[model samples]
Target: MEVISGGFHAVFPMEDGSRVGEARRHAAQLALDCGLDETEAGRLALVVTELGNNLARHAVRGRLLLSPRPALGEVDVIALDEGPGIANLERSLVDGFSTAGTPGTGLGAVRRLARQFDIHSSVPGGTVVLARVGAGPGPQEGHAICVGAVAIAAPGERVCGDGWAFALQGDVAALLVADGLGHGPDAAEAAAAAIEAFMEDPLASPRVLLAHIHQRLRSTRGAAVMLLQADVASGTVRSAGAGNVMARLVSGTSDRALLSQHGTAGIAVRTPEEQCIAWPEHALLVVSTDGIETRWPPTVLAPLLGRDPTLAAAVLVRDHCRGRDDATVAVLRRKD
Candidate 1:
């Protein structure tokens, strides 16, 4: 089976009131582009508008990220902010409780509109909210796999250096995570090149795919790249990497790190070696860039591994991110 993964879409800034409308328009268009009906698109637009308004009204700096899951006919909306976190999340989600003196229904409405919704916030830690809307009722029970991700630029930069993408063909799913050598436009260019290369032939082995990305990115700034392929029917995962991108497979109470060799992809890389690991039923595969703190104690990892992949990615980025750089996390779980 061949799977065509959705491309990495644009990221919208919600810094001021002016950007809120832009966020709404961008999300609505993305929903339509992903094959959502008009009704679904409208609901998504409204959710975006509400989240944007909340950011503008309360936070110092914020962004709305739009990622499409074409395989499921779904669009993911993630709203992240820097400061002035909610004081009372429960009250904020109440139907009529407003801190800005408006209708106070933004968060409530978003929950109602989304197929899946989650929010994490703290007074000093800022906020990250996730909402996923599907074109239809969603996938049937016992789907082979479910994948979700989040990528954000450095606090002061407009483009993120980290990027990720996935594709499924039959029982196999291939995932790519790339981090450009540094932050900003040149870095984003390198990451984008890797993504383009992966999409060109997503079903290739991880080593071959990374080799192709290395060739395509030689002219630009180099990046750290990792490719992971899961064979659901065989209950196994194969991985290859060049540089600092990290991959891990997590079961109910155990975590296994999938190591990557040292050296940049487009710069200096040795022959890539693919590593394979057993993936138990209901286990999760997580791939992330150096921007995230890799050494999490079991205490920190336990709660996160149980949530939806989107929310798990969001929480990990929210709690473990190294604020000085661009951060990204992608989570994949085989459905039961």
Candidate 2:
């Protein structure tokens, strides 16, 4: 399961009752970053406002996940949170049925308007709601190559805060995403170091690669490492995460989240016992950094990947981030 870095990621938390416009501008800016028109960007802003308003109040905390959708031919956003969980998901979606004592077109309206919507919620911990705005035709229509992806890097940030590695060693392809501890330079170093170590021996055993990276990255800043290796032609993929980073797959309308994490840092770190999630014909794979909140449970990344894995993953990151931190996601389409 080789994964690609979709080229955008941000997670910002919103304080309560902040003007919905603040969130609107941010979401629109993301749409704009993807080369969308003002009219299209403005339409997206309107939807973001509602999702933000819900999180600011009911959830108490909210993160905006946005990214380019070249793969899907559109841009997208997901407003996620870990606050008071929804009491009535069905009622909450109905128009003008907000518990806020204020009027709302409701989450359902946001769902209706977007190209796609994916949500998972529970009481006490809030929800993860996703929205997609298709820009045009995507990158996967008629393309052929061993693999394809979108990559991003800023001047000093040559080392992006989020790290990814994918290479074919015979029939198996190595895949992963790492989130260095916190944001800024330190986080970038931490993530880059581990990634460099992995790239050195992409064909090595996963456990061995993790061990090598843990030792190398501790000198910088600690980081979470999530790994995946697969040969689509052979129909086999294994996934594991050291910290919160996870590997997920979406095929058609279904999504399967891989959940097996060890230790955060690779060194003599007290690794968490390993746990593995199943993968069967997963078309798109997503790897994310810590900026994406774990508080918002339920995996929504895979489903949104239908049209474009890169854009879908980026949009998910932008929708569910804490902004104060550097957020990143890698999107990759499987060969199988």
Candidate 3:
């Protein structure tokens, strides 16, 4: 799906009642945009508010991520918080995990009230509430998903085995893209494993996250990674990466690559160094596995500068991954 031309982001502080109320309003607006009925929208609003409130009462802070489902036709929200990570998944789902244990019904109520609910949480890793509106898991119509583009990791052709993690951490959306060694199954597994490790804390610095992944991947394979965070509101982008993976921050015709002298993702252990640029809301941040490196056309990236990041990235992959190995294109678009 595309971003509302004006750009969409609303910050809500933990435990701040006003912030919770504002988040509910924002959730409602998003629900309406997703074709949700009034009642559905209200329910979604409540779900979001409840989740946000829980964050305030338990985690460092909470963030609400709005994006289009695979089908641009629908909208989805991912409530993010690495706090008070649920100790028990099944028990939490059964409802009543509250520290204060009030009505002990938020989780069950949320499940019964929403159209979709997919939750991922680890006791030490916090929680990410992923929910969708509009439709369920089925073949969505139209070759064109409302988003800009769509693509997948093809077979045969050599491609970078990198997966990316993006979330609004603090003032910027932290992006972590990791590429494993060569291509094929082993590389894919390596990259996937690293992604899981880094995602434990998407906001961690490049070096820290890389080190974490390295130690974890030791049992398996290793990888190379490029981590970047851009604060469009502040017009700044910071990036660091290892291995041969490349990241380009596009500002009009000027194409610049992000480079790091450190080791690879599964092996790095150096001080993180980054380059900062005057990022623009309409600027393009393109990242991919080596399989699809530098193959993106300037034209495709130009119009994608102000669109939904995931959508735009999908389009990039769709167009370039024709005969490639596992390929991933992750784009970050800022709004002015």
Candidate 4:
């Protein structure tokens, strides 16, 4: 079985109150599947209900994502909305603060019940909240690498053309992000094939892995692929890619772009060249498909880079998405 399992996503339109219960049921089930005791599962269910209700009651377009990290024994609940953003975040988190005239205890309860919590909101930019609950020691206590990712299909499509996966062993990790040539089932199939190839031999060098994926995808529709490898002990990152997928390494106040070469895997192809860069302590690595605008200022992304990886990925998907194609954002950070 995969290290991560029981992941689910739901979009709750702000038009009605039906999706709140749906989100709650899904989250409670996922929490149980991740091995949370009854008490912890109940707390997670409450967190989802509060967040989902807020979305149904207030936001414009909102979504909820629940993913289990079985290796870490945790479940992550993420809520995203493009609505009237919270103006006074600190006050909103205080108990008894309510604009909708209800109990006003939702945000406060979410903060109190979750082991890890974070929220970011702004007018015109919308809001993203993340809550994590788990049974064992947290990822920060022992994990050498922590990864967060968000993948979404186009507004009307049923399957996302973009795909991503990662493998971790000891102090090293390998990551892959693939964007099939177009959107829909064919594209998704191509991306899935690439992921299967990646899973078969995840520890290969970036160039070698990309070549293998290219070979595996020859019968499919083909895709743009990027492979990345990071060595925590040496503080280095190596990346190789083809087509328009973007990669960047951010450290402190600065950001450096990692370039991919021309060509598409399994179609018009080239011998991919791996690029090496220094990854300083606390630096973050972001890999995303072309669906996101690549010119975001470092200042705007600084705060997100320091947040939970999943929340950070969601913020990028929410703020920078082009909305015309499948979108994906993946983040990697060293916990120490």
Predicted model with the maximum lDDT: 4
RMSD in Å for all candidates: 4.0, 8.2, 18.4, 3.1
Per-residue CA lDDT of model 4 for 1-336, tens digit only, reads 122212224344445578778777767777777788888888888888888888888887887766666666678888889868999999999999999899899899999999889999888778999988876766544448878788878778877888888787767878899999999889989898988898888888999998999899999999999999988998899999999999998767668899899999989778779999888777788999988889876566676666777777888877788989888888888874
Q: How far in Å is the alpha carbon of 211 misplaced in model 4?
A: 1.1
Rank by lDDT (best first): 4, 1, 2, 3
Q: In model 2, how large is the Cα lDDT of residue 328?
A: 58
Report how far off residue 4 is in candidate 4 (Å).
5.0
lDDT of each: 0.81, 0.61, 0.59, 0.81
Question: lDDT by residue for model 1 over 34-83, one digit each (tens)?
Answer: 89988889888888899988888887668787877766788989888877
Q: Model 1 — TM-score against the truth? A: 0.78
Weakest 10 consecutive residues of candidate 4 by summed lDDT: 1-10
lDDT by residue (tens digit), candidate 2, 87-186: 8778878888866688878587788767666666656655767677755643233222133222333323434566665665445567667777766577
**Candidate 3, clashing residue pairs?**
1-147, 15-56, 72-146, 149-314, 149-315, 159-291, 160-290, 160-291, 224-265, 281-334
Q: Output the better candidate (1/3) by TM-score.
A: 1
Off by over 4 Å in 1: 1-41, 52-75, 80-108, 115-128, 134-142
Q: What is the lDDT of residue 205 in candidate 1?
A: 92
Residue 35, candidate 2: alpha-carbon lDDT: 74
Q: Which of the numbered candidates is closest to the native, going by highest TM-score?
A: 4
> What TM-score goes with each of the models?
0.78, 0.56, 0.52, 0.86
